[model samples]
Every structure is written in structure tokens, then in C-alpha cells.
Target: MAASTAQNTTGATGRTTTNTTIRRDTRTLPAAALGPENPLPPLLPRNDPHRVSEEQRATLPAEMARQIGYAPLTTVLPTRIRDGYTRERVPTAVDVIVIENDRLRATVLPGYGGRVHSLLHKPTGRELLYTNPVLQPADFALNGAWFSGGIEWNIGATGHTTLSCAPVHAAVVPAPDGGPMLRLWEWERLRDTPFQVDLWLPEGSDFLHAGVRIRNPHETTVPVYWWSNTAVPETEGTRVLVPAEQTWHFGYQRGLRLIPTPRWEGTDHSFPLRGTYPADHFYEVPAAARKWIAALDETGTGLVQTSTGALRGRKLFVWGAGPGGRRWQRWLTEPGSAGYAEIQAGLARTQLEHVPLPAGAELSWVEAYGPLSADPAATHGPDWARARAEAEERLTEALPAAELDAAHAAWLPHADLAPTETLHAGSGWGALEVASGGHELPGTPFDPGTLGSEQRPWLELLDAGRFPEPAAGAVPGPSLVSPAWRDRLECAPGGPLTDYHLGVAQWHAGDRAQARRSWERSVAAAPSPWPLRCLAVADGCEGHLDAAAERAGRALDLALDAAAPAAPAAALAALAREAVPALLAAGRAAEAGRALDRLPAAIRAAGRFRLLESRVLLAQGRQDAARAVFEAGFEVADLREGDEALTETWAALTDDPLPEHYEFRMRPS
Candidate 1:
């Protein structure tokens, strides 16, 4: 009976009969690690004077507590207060798992987020993916630590995913085709979900196969966002190809807007052209059957990413060649290193879109990353599409139906798998052991808004060292705020504007003393009203009414003197709003009235400034006028307003004792 079954079917092409083998090696290398001993620090100080008071927390709703991951007005919020990875590169050892066959070699860093550190095409000895020179971490992750380069598997919530910087269970398995494979598994604590990725380099194949599975372990439904971010060398002629006719553009502050792809006029946003401005757009890949995206350089040598399962979203995120782009490169990598662009694929149509996994449900798919040869000049829309189709055909041929199905079945019993054999440092070849852990890694405990807005013109201005002047008849940029601004300041410090921005970030982070110090430094460098106004706000928050009044008076004078076309009206409005409170606190009701009178009508009508007006009227012993101001402000923009700026203003005015909500801001924290 066994002999009869062994008989081959005519021209079935089910499995490979040829002798092929793959090698797996593991080594310990010096790298940074983040865990309980070294936890990430809070972005803001806990003792910040501006923090919501205990009295305020008591009045807030329970929902707000759940949203912020803590009770309202609590002094000690249940934040994920872990120290970040140390910058001092120590001799801390890390496990490096290498899997290779005749055609390709791939390295996996199991100790560092289980990322595919490098993928190389053996035939050409060319790296198929961008490899970071160092294993450095930045405060860009939703949990407050992110690293650039290579391929990062983002699962759970948005941003870089909670596990991007954490270690995952990894192991080596025997491929059905007789090649070696590496598998990584991570249990997401936040969502009570478990996920795994099985990677292999089949013999005689140029592509690396990644089998991904995400399972819901809970009884209730779970919402999830999964994306694979692959970085490649971006150059003047590097072009990204995704078969999409139109794209959705989502900016830092700018919401969703649609634009045609391949070309966007004057911009020529076609992947081959050199992008002058930063772009973070998502293109919908309606090609439900087979999805593919790639990035090719001028040399016609590049890499392609294709998925055999559902792929609703394709993304191209590039830090343009402009000053802002350059600064971000410096921030994410070591200096003098070339910046790279990202070609990403997701299960949803957009980054903000998520899917709900039913109880006991599981979703599985396969993705391929391979090298491509093409005519660089001809690798546009149709040309790239043809190349993708050919690549898919090749992959299908290499991974036949019988062999692929067997491999899928092996991965389904994730927990029953044996431990990966560990290879000691300098061992000829080995693999890292991976197994499911009892718990998920610690992630950010606070609400998403704690990270702040990514799109701040003030930050770009500080990085560019020049104000962003609008074109004739164009509206000026929006006002600058704290939030993620501190992360930017850390990258490039020393300038007057940078210091001023730093002060704002510090103030928001609850470090009034540091905020004052930064503002003082800014005043010394450029003597601008911006720094003085920020200083006044800090002083008032600290209960230094007299000092606040003096600073506010000087700030008001400087703002009036510096008022010009280039000056940001938003800054002027900020000064007026802050000065009135300081003057009122210092028992200078008349002075507060004068400051209120000088404010523009538009500023007075603004919700935040209206709160200031009410404060000014109250200090003048006119309680009725203050109430009227609050009533009118609420009538125009209620506490439930959708706009973040207005909602923050409402929180400040009502002293709602609840944390400000900015959940509307998209992920990638």
C-alpha cells in the first residue's frame, strides 16, 4: 500500500524530489536590551505643576480613566515607566539566528525584536534590504522605543507595534522542502492575542518566505492592526512600485485627502523621481487575488515584497530630500549614514483601519521578499506589474501545492513545536530557541495622545532654521504644541527656536523647572517673546504670581513690537491668552483688562482665549461677565468638540479634571 502511494502522479509537480538542504547558525553579538531592569522613562515628569489635580480627577467619568490607563487626576498615573535602551553600547550579548540556502542568506535578531536584520542575495552578494549600521533605539514607538532599518513586524496596536523593540520567542524548524527555517512567536498582552511568523529560505530560490499567523486567544472579539515595514536603500533614482490608481494622503496634521498615483503633477511623485517633500501616504491595492509592491534603484537592482493572502493596503513612506527629511534621518540613524525609504503592506485599506478577530478565530497568510532584475527606466506602472506577475509565478513554481500545504499544517500547532537549537557565539552555524512566554512584554500604559502630534511646523522650522513662510495667499502653518515635540528637540538642540520648543515640551511633560531653564536659554540666544511667554506660563503654574506677571508684561511688549508678516499669529495669540491669567494672578486686574483689549477679535472668540477672557473678567470682580464668556464659548465649541485644539481648550476652561483626549489622531504614535 505504501509503495503504491509513493508512485508519482504524471506531471503533478507536487513536491521536489531533488536533494536540497539549508543551514541555520546562531551567534551572540553585543547589543542593547530593554526590560524590567532597564525600563523606559516617562516622557513627562510626574510632579509637573500643570498636571490635573486630585480634586479634578474625582469629577471625571470612569471612561476617561479607562482611556488614560489610570484614574483621573491621580498623581501617580499607571504609565509604563520603564527605562529606555541605553545609548552606551555595552557588551550585552544578543542572539543572532542565520538561515541560508544555496540562493539566499537571512539574519534574524531574536534578542532585538525578532527582526529580520538582513537579507542577502547570494548570487550577487547584494543586500536585498536596508541594514542599519547600529542597533540603536529611538523614542518613536507607541511604547516609546523604535529602531530603523531592516524588516519590522508591527502587530497589536498602531505605531511601531509594542513588540518591535522587545524580544520574541524564536526557533529553527525543518522545512518540508528539506531547507532550514526560523520561527518567531509573540503574545500581545494588550489585546490578549498571540501571533507568529515562520521564515524560510528554500533551496535554489531567490526569495525568503514568511508565513504569518495571528490568533485570538480570548473569548471576546479582538481588534488588531498588523503591518510589515520593510526598508530599502533610497536614492535619487530609487522608485517604489505599487499597483494602485489612486492613493490616500494622511499628513501629520492634515487629515485624509485623495490623490492620483504614479504622477501628481509638478511633484511627479512617481517612485522613480526624487521626492522633495516628505510623504506618508497609503495606496489601496484592489488586486485582491495577488498583491505585490517593490522598490528598485537606478541600477535596476532592488527588492520586491509580495503577499499570497489578503492585502488591502500598500504604503510608501519616504523622508524626502529636503531639510526636514535629512533631520529625521539623523534622528533615526547615526550621522553620515544614508537615509532609506519604506515599502509597507497591511491587511487593511489604511493604517487607521483595523479588523476584528472573532473569538477563537485565526488569520494566516504568507509573504515573499525577493530580489528583482529590471530595466530601471521601464519599471513604472505596467512594467512593474509584469515583473510582479512573473515573480509570483516563480514563487508558485518553487513552492508547490503539496509542499506548501504541509508547511502550513506544521505551523498551525504553534505551541507543540520544539525549542530551537541554540548555537554558541562563534559556533560554525546554529539557530536561536523560540517558545511562547507566560506573558507579553510591557508596553506604554498611558493613552495614545501622550505621544503628541507628529506634524508641527514649529519643529520643521527649528530643524530647517527658517520659518515656513506660506506662498502668497496661502494660510500660515498651525500653532506649535508640546507632545512629541520633545523627541524632535532631542535630535537637534542649541538653536533659539529649538530651545523655545523644548521649553514647551518640558512644560507639557510636567517639568516646569526644566521648562523655565530651556525658556531662559532661548531668551539668552534670541531674546524672543516666545520664550518669555512660555516662561510666564511655567511661572504661573508654579504659583509664582509676581514672577509670572513680570514675565507676561515683558512678553506682551515684545510680542507687540515683533508683530510682523513673518511672525506666527498663533504665537501672538498664545501670549495674550497666557498673559491675562498671569496679570490676574498678580492682582493686576486693570493690566489683565488691558491685555484682553489688545487681543484680536478672532483671538477673543477662540475657545481657549475665551477662557482667558473669562478669567480676566472674574479678576475684575465681574463674575456675571465671566459666566457669559464661558456660556458663549461652549455654545460655539462644546467640550465634545472633535477638533483636538478646541477640546484641549475646553478641558482647560472647565477644569474638567479629565485627561485631554486625542484618540482621533492616527496611530504610528
Candidate 2:
């Protein structure tokens, strides 16, 4: 088989037939280039200044990073195993079998990316689990191929949607001594497909591991979030335990509890699932964890669910200590009343093992999965310390040290749950909602957050300040914006980057003092390129153009160096140029000149600054000379581009006779 790719899910044909493995270019975006703007919006608002308002200063809950308790749970293999064959590093995608001394066997299938038309389950030996029906892929929303994106999808793909579950590997590991061993096949295929798993107790073993391996073909990497959509009839009873801070209360709203990240650091928060909820997609677990859900029941079903980590890093177990709701979740035939406990662990970074390497140069992540369970809640009894110990011990003894190290190394890329820096490689975030509409944001940024179902790209944007929200205008009163990257901030006592935009918002709303304060807090707390820009905006709006220019110049450098969007920085630069004379008149010519020259040549050419330059130059008695620069340089171009082609929202407000400016109306990149 020549190195290439093929998707069984029919859409359109004509894929490249070459066998050359496509490697992701490590070229950091010149602006950390992700996509060459494919089609960067030709026109953007010219409003860079954020005028503060009283509403901007509205106090909100401060969220912090460490509150959610995000730590990678590591399991090093037991050192007692023999050398060579038994202790050799277990490569991913290899099939191995475990033969028990007491007479039991388990098969391991790693990285087998295909459909299992014939369902197969073990242990219990009732092929019914896999034989009932060929659970074909669904075509509706609650789950469907409705929201999809790839360069081709953008070009001309019908429906433009589909859930992606890319498979990674499968490992058939034996249980400690002679217990219920497992055949763990980790795959990431979108819109979950069911399989037949066999559970063999082998007379003496008390535990087993259920594993599923998937295949991902989509260009974008998404967290494998398929729960047991089909509810097992609990004529006996069933329960799913999920960790959460406050059990999702209120109402079932959209068949799922939509939890907002406290602030945009990274969803690093978690608590026990409390109260009642009939969830379809209960988003109780924070972004910190995406796979590894647990299910158990009063009748003795202690099942631990989980997935493999992708680029986002870290796998999770979705349950904690709590019993706030009913004993079991509503069956699929009924409503899903409980939530799943899971974690978002990063995936292995090496692509040397993939069959047909994916396109694009960004880091991609897919989840690995398995189901660990127990039964008769009372059978184990109080503390159930013995049972817990047995399970833990089996899980520990299941692997040899070499294999664990190899797997651990593969997963190192996503080890840091709290990634404070942007990806030097490919990093993308798209809005997560599956919109029923067509092409929004046209030629601008890919906005997945506003669309509704947040993908990693959207989260990255919010964390990186690409969306620049009032994410859906906030909730008013106290809360504002959904918390995706909430726990990564300095929030609670105050968070990083929180006040920077708020200051700009208040500044834009004309709340100078609050803007100043927010700006101060923004810089002091995190000191990003934003704080300087916020300070500049505050100064310019307050008629302290001289100070504004100083702040603006510094901010631009930071934004440019970070490969961040330049619209805001550009707007600030243009505004500072206009404020030169105000500085000179205030006897600050030295600093004012420096600010003017500091503006990059490209931004100065945008034209908004010429208006102020006209005033500044004329005041310096170089009226003719000033007129020449304004007319030949700035004004003429402004006239050609027209007053409407500005990137900053407050551009018109700046002496540039442009028009009303607002960043929201501009397309997001």
C-alpha cells in the first residue's frame, strides 16, 4: 500500500495518490503562521482604541488556575517482570494475547483503524452486545456529520459537518496474576460506533479492562467525546459518576449542562457531579480532561471509562466522591440522567507510526478508550478498600515498565495540562457549535466559539485574545463569557488578561478611570502586549496622545513578536501617530517623535494617522511639509482604500472621518 489516505465515509473522491508521507512544516507562524490566511479578510475596522465605561469595571468572580486540580495521573509499570519478551516495550498498534495460568485469555488490538462489522465482546461471552445491530453512524445533530471543516470543506463540501473520532492504538494487556484481562483497542472515530466486547471472568479473576481503538481522518484534531450514547436498560439499575464543582443544576436546558470556563486560561476546574440532570452531552468535566469516564451502579457495575490523549494533553477519569442524584442514570431508551467522569490528557507526539500521515502542519490529538467496571456496590462493602486495592494493583501490574515508559514518552507533548504558551508548531481553534447556517465570518477568522460547540481552536483564540469578546455579550449582572480556559488565570483574587480587555471595553464605553484601573490590573497581573495597548488606548481617549503613543509603540512590538493578530496593535500605532502634536504642544516632542517613527511602515500607510500628522506638522510650523506627507502618504491611500477599510473598531472615533468602528463586526481570524 503506497503511503496515502482513504476515507470510507463517502463525500467526494479525488485524493492525492502519492505514497509520500506529508510532514507538518515546523515553520512557526511568521505571525506563527497556521494557515496562510487562506483568505484574510480584505477589509477590517480601524478601531484600535478601547474606551472604558462604568459597566466595564463591573466586578466579576476572579478564577484561578490551580483550583481545578489538573495533574497527569501516571502509572509506572511494576519492576518485577522478567526481561526481554515479557518486559520488552509494548509498541502501540501491536496485537498481543495474555494467557493466564488459571486458564484465561485476553487479546490486545492496538491502532486498528476500521469498522468491526461483526461485533465481538468477551468475558460474559454473550455476543449480544456486539450482535444486536450494526449501529451505523447517525445523521442527526445531538450527533451527526453536520459541522465539518478542512480546506476542501471551506472550498465546497456539502453539509460541511461531521463528528471526527481518529483512532490511535490498541493494546491487549493481561490482568494482574490471573484476573479479568483486557483487550484495549484505542481508536478516535467521530460519531461513536459501537463494538462487541467479551468479558471472561476465568473463574477466579474479579476485574477486566474494556478497550476500543479508533481511526481519525479529519484534518482537525478534536477530543474524542463519544459517551455511551445508547443507555443500557437498567431494569437492574445503573449509575454514571462525573467529577464537578457544583452538580449541573437548573434545568436540562439542551439535554446537557453547559459549563463555562471561569476565565480564559484553560478549563482547569473540576468538582463532584451533584443534583439532578438528564444529560445528552453533560459538559461537567472541565477542558483539562476529555476522556476516561466511569460508570457504576448499586447492582455492582463499577465501570471506569476513558480515552487516549491527543495534542491537548492528559487523559482523565470522570468520577469523584459524591452521591447527589438518583442511584442510576436514565437508560438510553430513557433519558441520560447522569454525567461521565473523564480527563483531557495529551496524546503521543510522534507520527512515525501512523499508517497514512495527516495533512497540515499543526499538532493533532485523538483519544484512546476503555471501560473498567465492578458490580454489586455492597458486595465490595464499606470502604471497599480491598476491592480498590485489587483493581489498582491489577492496573499497575497490567504493564511492564518498558511499555509504560514508551507510552509515557509518546504522551509527553501534552504532559503540561496548563500550557501557558501558544504552540510554536501548528495550533488551531474553531468555534464548537454545529451551526445550521452557512458561511459566517466569510473571509475572516474561523470562529467556532460563537458557532456554539467550542473546538480547541476557539478556546485557543479566547486564551490568545483572537475572538475579543463579550463572548455573546456576557450574562450581565456578575458573570460574563463562558469559562473555557477559566482555571489558568489569576482570577478569584484576580486573573491574568482579565482586566486588559475589560479596561479596553470600559475605555471604549467612555469609563476612563475604570479603564485605567483595569489596564493597571491587566499589566500588573499578567503584563501581556495587551496591557500596554490598553494603556495607550486609555491615554489616547483621555487626550493624552503623547502617553498613548508611548504605550502603543511598546504594545505593537509585543503583539508582532508573538505572531498575534496585528489589527489591535496596528490601530494603536495609527492612533499614536495622530496624537503626536498633542505631545509636542505639551512639550514632549522628543517622545512624540520617537512614537511616530516607531510605527511600522505598513501601519502608517493605512492613513488614519495622517489626520493627526496634519495637525501635528502644521502646529510645528512645517505646514507645507506636513501637508505633503499627509496628502502623498496617508490621505491619498485613505482616499483610495476609502474610509471604510480600517481594522480597529474605534478608528472613526479617532480624527479619521472613517465611520463607526467595532471589532465585533469585523471578521475573526
Candidate 3:
């Protein structure tokens, strides 16, 4: 952690300022590698029930209607599930980009989705964010594999960004107010857009400024989502303040209700520890109010996040004081670690909505993060209005709203400045997109030279109008579901691989019937398991459970037979996961058991398979065996956010209350 520090008197405005240094460093932590992704494609669409009621929808403004759940993802195709991480932890060195001034230090992890891993205030030597002790990947992001802590830029969909564990291009650029700025940019695949984040620390400022811009290069309107999620250490005395008397409460029960902001259910909901279950409190900030949110402790000193007017919404997410909430805290990191809550800012009122970016248009906003301190008694007082006023007064004093607006205007010109140095490289998809569409993104260049193996096939298809086939027994490559690529794929020479990818692209476009026909043609050309499993999904979606089971079983058998002896276990596990559930749905419990047994012993030992095994055992009337599976204590690495299967299965097996370790229920029943 040692590094050299020096003073450089240079400013973006040509005025001399205090000392500031921008350098690279490494941190050693107990980390687990994000292993290979699931080979099986996600055929089913994201079916999270995140819709608002008719009455609530009617009350929303016209712009809200355009954004609410627009262009829902049919599938997370191009991005695969990253469920390969395990509980085993080993010390590893992680690269970090540090930008520090005389008053503060901001450590950025460009390799980890450009996460602001730590923000330290120099005067107090206090960390402003909840910096995680270990790097543990969990199934939290939109495409799985997310770590908890620091500040994360959530984009693309409602959930965490697909690039949570992926790398992003980083470089040094000129800061608006002075010194060097750290810029991170990447191509967001779900919306087919490119976005950039510039981090600037003025010479002597406590606040870390982030300039964000998302551009839709296509001719058609695109639904865009952006949220800056900051994790702060939570304690019983911590209180969150937003300038709103009412808030939207959304629990895991798939319902959203407007309730009083601070006091709800005769308890102070502003305190993260007051609730009994995990929940989201989206503050209903007034249109005229300055948009900001702060998490202050009893002593009235903590992190505050504020943005320009365009970034309108603010929220607080807490894994509450309940047993399940406490258990989740331990599951994400190491045991006995301090709990944390998320204070977030977003474009829409709720994460369930997306804002529409018009054709060939872009949206830009500036967010400032720093430490806030106010009178302890007033901030933690019984009077909610006084507490909020104290926070607002302190925030304005630290960083004025007008100052933030001026900063945005000043940074606009520098946003397009070319990078002086490239620190890290992200995915080649952005370059591939530029290669195909010929986009002219100036500052955030997706250099064609960065294209690698993953983009080679798509590049070939773009150049030759044919998707190249992989070697025998090799898992299918990544998918491209954009309209232009789909059109090229449609005209490509018909083959097993080409037809299979075309079916996926068609499915993403919502043409189910055509997708089915394409998959059938793919199977007819070459009877491979990939297309067969896809057909299984189609059957299940169509409510042909028996046919789905049969297809899944056939697909599983083919995959096992064709797999090499040393093939990655994930390849087999992917098919087995789909087949087992389908078999159970078709009431073929015995067949499910046989299918589960076919997997290697180690794969079956994983948490997901063990849960499936419990279901299979219960179906066979072996209640004791099912209970044993739960008692063995397996962790579902890819357990979805709102999935209640764990608790539901526990209830079905016995009358006993669900075990604390398995209690991830976010809703109060």
C-alpha cells in the first residue's frame, strides 16, 4: 500500500491549488476468482414482477409512463451467468487507481467495473464509504457475480449492472477544476449504448465529483437506466435523511406502497436497523427541492450524495435488523463483519423504471460525494423536519447546489477531451460495436485494436456475412441480439450455429414463433444439445411440461455423452439445472433423481444442485432426506434477489420455523 506523494500546482482553470496525486497501486485481500460462466443460454426472459398498480401508473406523469419498465429484457443473452465463484478465499493482489488531493483520497478499481472502492477524508482519516474487507462475488448483479461495498454505478437494467465483475477501459484525462481526472468507460450491451464516468478530485476539495454521460448512438429511442449506489456502514444509531415527507416502500412481496418517510408502522423507518426485513425506501423528493440523500450517524458525520437536477430520485436500501437480514450480511462477506446499507441516486422514481433517451441523443449529469457533519442533537432529534433541515444546511455549506451546476457546465467541454494515458482495457464489445456501426465517440474511444477472441466471430460475420462455427464439443460462443446483428445473422449462410444464434436473436426480439422454427431447423441440421435445451425452454414457456421434460432429458443426455472427460463441470451443470426443474414440473421425480445423479459429485455438492436435490427427495416422499439437505448448510451462490424457493421448500418439508442460515426472506408474512 506504499506510494510516493507530491504536490503539483496545476488547475483545470489555470489557478494554483493544493497538492493532488493520481497514481496506480495494488491491494491484497482474500478474493475468489470469478470463474467461467454458464454455457447454457438464458432462454427465458427476466420475469421479475416489478410492475406498478393501475392506479399508481395512472398517477404517474407522462414522462414516467414512457420510462416505466420500457423495453424489458427478454433474456440476458450476451452476458452469461457468473455463478462459478466459491466460498474459498485466498489472498490476491488487486489493482487500484488512486486519486488524492490535500483533503481526500479516492481509490478506484477500474478493473472491477470502475468501482470507487474507498474514499478517505484526509483531515479526519475516516473512510466515507463501506469498503468491504474481502472480494467475494455473489449472485446479485443483473448477470450475477456482484461484490458488496464502496460506490457502484448501476446501469442497463433494474438490477445491478452486468459489468459488476467485468473490467472497464480507464484513462487519465484533464479535470475541469484542476489536476488529472480518472475516466472509465464501457459499452453497455443490454441497451447497446456506451457510457463514461469521469472522477475528479479538485486540489483541496473534500467532495469527489463524478461526471456521467450515457449516449444512445442508434437511430431508435432507447430506454436507459442509471443509478449511483453507495454502500455506507450501518449502525443502530445511523439515520438517513432525504427531503421528502413520503416515500415509496417496495418489499420482496412484489408490491410498492407510498408511506410516510421517517415514521412508518409506528417506527422510525429512516433508521436502517428499525425494520424487520430487507426493503427499499424511494424518497418522493419534491420537484423544486435540491436532490440529495445522506446517511449520518448519531454524531451527525457521514456520507452525503447529491447530483444535478437531471438525476432526480434518491433511495435508501437496508438489509434490516431481522435475522434474515443479519444472515445476508454475513453471507456477502466474512462472518462478524459490520453491516452496511445502500444510499442510492437514480434517474427514475424507482429502479423498476427506465428513462427514454431519444434517437442520437445523450443524457449527462454530475454527482458529488463527500462527508457531511451537522449538530448531533438536531440530526438525531425526534423532530424529523429539524433533522432534515440540519442535513440540508450542512450539505449546502459543504457543496452548494449552484457550485455543482457550475462544475457540470465547466466539465462539459473537458468530457470530450482525448485520454492522455490508458491505464486499463475493458471488453472488446465496444470496439466491435464501433466497427459495425461506425460510431464517432470522441473521448471514449472503443479502439478497434482492443478486439479479442470473443469479438472475432461477430467481426467475421460482419465482414463475411457468415457466423463461424466452433470446433466439435465446444460450447457455443456468446450471443448478439441487436437489430443490425440479427439482420446480418438472418441473411447469413444457414447452418447449425448460425440458425441457433438467429433463434436466440429472434427470441430476444419477442418473435417466439419464428424463434421456435429457427431452433427446430438448427436441431434438424445437427442434433446438438444447445438447440434441444432451447426447445425445452420453448415447451416450458408454452405449458407443454411433458414435452419440455423430454426435450430437457434428451439434451442433458447428449451433452453428457459429447462432453470430454476433462470438460468444465459448469457445462454439464447448466443443462442439469434446467432439466431437473423441468422433470419435476412434469411429475417425473424419478427421472429427475437419475439426471441429478449423472452430474459429477462435486457439481452436485454445489448449493443450487443441493436445493434441487431436496425438491427431488421431497417429490419422492423422502421428507427426512429433504430436511437433511437443508441442515447440511449449502449456500446458493446464484440465489436470485426475490426468490423464495429456499424458505418455501423449508416450509413444505416440515412444520419447524426456517433456519436462520437459510432465512433470506425479504418480506414479512
Candidate 4:
């Protein structure tokens, strides 16, 4: 059987065919007995961030549209049709509603182009499909895409939730090879809630396909965590393995990689988990797979969990490493592998990793799994190496590097500005006053507040050139919400703000024109805080750098929010300083100036990470202040002895901040 190439259906792992179009009960088109081709004109490319089409959701059918008094799927593609769900189920919040096939008309399996939400599968293995809908986190502490390892009590009947399926914007492009390919159109206009989708694997075909419409219909972002539940059969006798760079081991050689803490738990990778009592739990998977397979070392029960999902890489426990397994079953009954299951709390994407997709952009996570052993040909050799690399490339879109860059730079556009109106409204000079013509200081960075008692003593100390001392206080520390809450609300990493962060992927990978359009999509998807700050900066860069900043900033914020020790204040200092220059370059001088004035002077005196504070000093233009800043904090002694980007930036500005070795070490020199 040929697997679907996404290029077309012919030669796809299975022999497949799309039967003649079935007219909707509503579209009285008896006369228009549609030919093999679609009657509608091809849709425009969906690039608008404000529209659902761009988010890539399948639309409602003509019948459902008429019933609802509005047409759908007009903007999306690979429509849903037929009446009454030919399948059924009941989906309470935690449980899934399965929709099975009675007439064999439905085709949705991992490989059938179903676009399942998890990361692993077989039966075509192209994409994973799910019967679960999107879930949200009502509380900041919990993951939105929650999962339950309890046995599925009832795969209910009567189609749990009624659905309106129709053709979406994606069109089927016929390849020259005579195989049919799908080319999605009008993706920007088809937005709405993501619904529960099911799978139906035919005995012979290589492809099964389905899609969803995750829309942000409002001007605001729609926060969500999608969960997937699959029923992978359980076998026996096989071992289990969790993939990750650092793993914790437990019973029977079971391994897991978790966030290390003072007191750690779970089986780690380096250790072996050998036991016979039933065992199941959660653990971290490696960040890189290189298409590597964490096999169970048997004929039928060797695969435990795999990385494979279209938008999100899935984590599964296979009966022999079944599909998308969660905490319940990672081992089979016989000894080969175990049953497979999909577990995710929507803490993020494909798995429980907490990945978010900005409003207008698409975030895809790809992973692949099949049979393998240490036998070189399949396990440690060319074939294994080749497939592993290929799989890695598939999910690279969601890799931490690029998105991390975007998220870190998310709030960058307003870094240089003071948070209050006083410092900014009075001087248009912004950071220029502090760093003009190589005369800026080399102090670490700091943001000032409204000048309160809390910051008063520190300011005095900073003015006197004594830094970082204020933070030595016993009670209120980095965990304390900076008493400096001056109406600064940013997007929580996976929250509504910075919803446009996902747009970077499209821009980065698309063509020039596509990139520019995606840039607009990026801006449009950003949170309100970003645009407000950008307006505080300038409008031009708002679409590019500012957009990038919003993504990066939100990611950084999420990281900070999820951070173990949870220090918002330290993150603030770091996030703000990095944001300053970008905001300045973006031309939001006023905003930049406002933020600059907010730096706590104490950070200035340390001269170590003093760039933030030094920025303010340079602004004061007290040559002594500027020089003092240049001389403070973070002893990267070899590199001007500082652990501050601002210091590095300042040294680069001051030429001799350490000249002789300057060009040799500092970048951007």
C-alpha cells in the first residue's frame, strides 16, 4: 500500500477514491448534479489575520449553513457533509465523543490526511485525528487541554455534539502525476471554535483526511488547549521507553525526563525501571528526536511512545508503543510493547508541553513512528537515521529556537520607553540622550517606577553608584509582584495576548509577498498591549519588529510565568531591557523613553548588570553617571566583566569599554 504523499492520492499507501459529490439536503441542486470538479471558484489565499480562513479551519456544510441561516465552509475546505453524523457519542468536558462509520463513507486516520491533533499513528500515519474538542484553562495554574487516563467508560452514541461540516478554503490540486493534491484557499476567513473530529479507516486506502476551524472571531485572542484521545490496543511482554535528552528511569527500565527540582520524582533516563506491578505516569520527552525511535525491543510490543502529529507532536504509549499514549498504558500484556493512548492537557501543543499558536499564524508539530529495533537497518543505521532526521524536520516548525526568539522579543518594541508619561512627554530624545555617538554608559539595565519609597532609597544608592543592594531584602523578593504595577498587562505565553506570535512561522517560511502579508497578519494577531506600546513607539516597525517583539515577549512571559521559582521581577528587568532597543529602532521613542525612566536606580549602581540603569544615567548626561554606568555590574571580566546584554550593547557603544579586545570578542562590533 502506498502512503499519501500530500502531493496526491494515487500511489498513496492505499487505493482511494472520493465518491461523487453528495448534494446537501438543503441545496436543491438536483439539476446541478455536480461533476467531479467543485462548482465554486477557487478562493483567494487566506492571509488576513482578522479572518478565520487564515487560521485554517474547515467550514460548515451547505445544509448546516442553511439550517443556521448562514453559509460556511465558504472560506475553508475539505468540507463535512452527510446528515445526522452517521456516528455518535456524548462529550462532557473531560470525555471524548467518538463518531464511527456505519456506511464506510468517512475516512479519517493518521495517514488519511485527517490532521489528527496528537503526534502518533498508523493506518496511513500522515496525521492524527481526534474526537475531542478544544479546552481552555479557567485558572492560571492548570493546563487547558486536560486529559483523563481513566478507561473511556462509554464511547457514547447519537453523535455527542452536532456538527456543521462543509468545504473549507483548501482546494484539491490535481498533480501532473494524476494524483490529487489539496491546495487550501481562503484560510484567513474561516475562523471559529475547534470541534470534535473522528476517524474512519477503510480497509485499503492510504489516506484519510479531515481538518478543523480554530477561529478568533473577536478582536481578541481565543485562549485554548486542544486535547486528543485515541484507543490504541494493548498487547504484552514489550518494554517501554520515554524519549528526551535527560530521562529518569524507574521499574522495568522505564525512563522519564521531568523538570528537575530540589526533590525529584519519577523514573529518570539514566536509570532502569524494572517491575512487574502495573505502572503508569507522566514524564518529559526529549526535545530532539532526530527521527530516533524509543523502541521497546520486541517484535510486537517494542514501541511505547512516539512523536507524530500534524500541528503538535503527540506523545503516545503504544501497544508495542501504541499511538499517543498517556499515563495509563505504555506497556502491553505479552511483553512486546504496550497499548497506545493520546494524552494532553492543552498545556500546549500536540502534547502537554504548553505550546501556543498566535491568532493569524499556524503552529505545526510533526513526528513520525513505525517499527524499529537496534538492528542497525531499522534501529541504529542509515534507514533509521534518515527517517529520524526527516521526522525532526517535519516538526521543526514548533521547535523552541525560532518561536523562542519570537516570544522573547515579543515586548521589545517598548523597551527604551519609560512606563510613565513624565519622562517620555518631556523628551523626544529617548535612549539617544544616553547612547549618542559612542558616549553612552556601560551599566546594566533597569526600569524606574513612579518614584516610591520602595524605590527611593534604591535610587539614592544608585545615584551614589551603589547597585544591586536593594534586592538583598529578606521579605519581598523577585517573587513579589513588583510594587511597580503601573497598568502593564502583557500576553501570557499561552494567553490571549501575543496571539499573533504564530504569524512569524508563516512570514519566515513564506515567499516575499507572502512574508509581507504574514507580517501584517502578525501585527493584527498581536495583543492590545503590543499595539498600544507600538503606537507609543511608531507605526512602521509596528508591523515587523514590533510584531516579532510581541511574539518573543509573550513567549518570555509564559516562560517566566511557568518558571519554577517564578520571578516576574527578574524577568521584567531582562524583558524590558531587550525591548528598549527594538522599541527605539521601531521609532516608539516616547514609549521607549517612558520605560527607560522606570528603571530602578539600584540596578544602576551595581555596574554589573547596570546597562538598564546606565541608560537612565546616560539620559541624565552626568558624564560621571554615564562613566559610572560604563564601569558597573555583572563581571564577564573577559567581556567587560558583565552578565548583561545592555552592558554588552553599551560597551559596543563606548568602543574602549574594553577596546583592545573589543572587535575580537563582542559581536555587532
lDDT of each: 0.57, 0.29, 0.88, 0.27
Tens digits of per-residue lDDT, candidate 3, 545-636, equal 99999999999888877746434688788889899999999999999999999888999999999999999999999999999998888988
The candidate that achieves the highest TM-score relative to the unseen native structure: 3
Best candidate (score: lDDT)? 3
Given candidate 3, what's the lDDT at residue 447? 83
Residue-level lDDT of model 4, residues 1-669, one tens digit each, is 212223214422244433311111111111111112211111222211112231122242233222222221222221111111101123322211121122222222211112222323343332222222321111001100112121110101101111111121122222212233222211121122222221222222222222222323233343333333333322232223333332121121222233331113442211112222222223333334322223333342222222233322223322112121121221111123333333221122122122223544332222222222333223223242343343334334323234323322321221122211111111111121122112221111112222344344333322442212222111121110111110111112221222222222222222234324433443454323222232222232345776544443443343234434443343444445455555555555555555545545543233233544455455445446656655543422111111134435566356555532112221122
Q: How well does each candidate superpose onto the true structure, as a TM-score?
A: 0.54, 0.26, 0.97, 0.26
Name model 1 segments beyond 4 Å from true. Answer: 1-93, 380-416, 420-669
Instruction: State the TM-score for model 4.
Output: 0.26
Better of 3 and 4 by lDDT: 3
Judged by lDDT against the true structure, how good is candidate 1? 0.57
Model 2: how far is 60 from its true place, Å? 9.0
Candidate 3 clashing pairs, residues 3+ apart or interchain: 12-178
Model 1 lDDT per residue over 98-150, tens place: 76665777877775567888998887899988887766665555444567889
* Alpha-carbon RMSD of each model: 19.5, 23.3, 1.9, 26.2
By summed lDDT, the worst window of 10 consecutive residues in model 1 runs over 427-436
**Clash totals in order:** 9, 140, 1, 182
